[model samples]
Target: MPFTGQLEDGRPFIATLALQAHGTGVVGDGKQLKFWIDPWLSTEPLKYKFPSLFCLEQDKRCNVADRIPDCNGSHAVCWNWKHYPATEMEIEELIQCHRLLSNVSLSKQVDRWVWRQEDGDGYSVKDARNWIKGEVLSVNNSVYQWCKWIPNKCNIFMWRASLNRIPTKDALLHRNIYVENGLCGLCGEVEESVDHLFSGCRFASGMWDAIASWCNIPRFYVFSLSDVLLVLNDLPYTAKKKDIMYGIIIIACWRIWKARNDKIFNGSVSSVTLLVADVKSLAFLWFKCRHKEGCIDWRNWCNFVLPVM
Candidate 1:
């Protein structure tokens, strides 16, 4: 039986452990498995993979056992698709799923969960721990590449901005929040989206140009926030230089966001000159405080020579 809160104060931990264990677990039989919720074939749950079909399902809690209908003479298993497709896309998806599952043959064996992480296909605490550790490292490497060097606040801002999670006008609108207008505050011609607010706006484009010139880097295109976050990776620079560039990029994003908020809340305006100056100042302060390898003066920072020395 599942542990209740009254019975187990540590139920949450057990739940988390089940989630972690489920990542490496695969289905051996169709019985005792919810058709929609179980991760039988793919890493994603079936409900997520086939949302339209799942929505049309009469029994949302129906298991795989209920879907497999017995054949007349042959001992073959067949799927009973009880739900109808609502759209052409859903129809195509259903056909695809049907083709994929057509080859899966069921046996009289009992339902069992097998761990894919272990060599013997058995669950082990060590294997689960290693799998969870690897998952954490993979997520951290992709999302927090520059978090260790930059300030937490700045890193978080950049992270959210890059993922387009900030409550921008467009984002709010998408979430069913009504706004008077969606035009960018800096450049009123374009929509105030994450890409436009940071990279596509004329004002933002000018700021990028100024930053590039100040950093002594050649002209480069920044079509989106992803370009800014991943610019250092594509550049042919030393690791130290790349680290400094990463911090500067984060500072620029944070300052741009601040300028946007100021315009929205305080009716203040930001110029390219002011934005570049702030980036330079903030980058210098952050690098000086957080980094201690080399001494960086104001002049070197302004001229973008701090990377060399």
Candidate 2:
């Protein structure tokens, strides 16, 4: 989280986004924790999971203890809804809410917060820093090195493309969206799947060939998007050169996607020479501006020469 605002007494204030995300409150008395806002019952707060119910809830600031009433010896869950649940979805959410509360058992001990990310109840600055930096391992088990030199939009696009999450023609078709033709917008040879668009398509292949020649690297005959991303890893180059190549590759991919969109939406023609030139100039601009050690001359950059580190 960003340390932005100052306190009332003029001290710097640290944002609690990390705290609220990783902090899991253990309900004991439940009086101190807000039922809808606090993540006591699950990893996510009920407000996010049950938005319909939260919206209908009359007492927005009601605590867990306020929502759950004591019935003689046992505790019964109660909701202070402004209006009764009318929609089927809302009714289902209400039922699920009750089911979530049915297994919860309150204790006499005071409610406490625990860091859900780590093993112990205590929070660690190292862990928080890692979480903030997005250093945590991916759920898909794919190790993607986020290029710091490139723009975040490029990195994000590459990440999504790596995960096959981008809305390619084939992806749109799979999602039941109507498409006159599912062939690649760039080449129109085969179906526009993630792999084909970024790697297998004739347009993408030419782009990669030109880039490889320009970068003084071996031709990357990739079959999938993963191959395109991991090609730099196998290259016999220094870490710094690999970093530069990775950023260039990401920019190329971003430009390819933009070209495809322009073709489909704006009737723009895709050109290999123009596209490669755009990639080279953009990669040069973004790298020189964003990277700390980016003092390479434009002439050397045009010739793909890396200054000795």
- Provide the overall lDDT of each model, using Cα atoms, as 2-decimal numbers: 0.68, 0.80
Local accuracy of candidate 1 as per-residue lDDT tens digits, 1-309? 322222111224343445534643244355655666666666566767876676556445556666654343233433444455758878877887777567655556665555544345566787666766765555346664655566899988877887678988888977899888988867677668887777767677777788778777765656568777777677777887877777887888788889988988899998888988888888788787777764778887777777444
lDDT tens per residue, model 2, 164-275: 7898988797789999898889888677888888876778888999999998987766757988988887778999888899899999999999999999999999798999
Candidate with best lDDT: 2
TM-score, structure 1 vs. true: 0.53
Given candidate 2, what's the lDDT at residue 131? Answer: 68
Model 2's alpha-carbon lDDT is 0.80
User: Using alpha carbons, what is the TM-score of model 2?
Assistant: 0.55
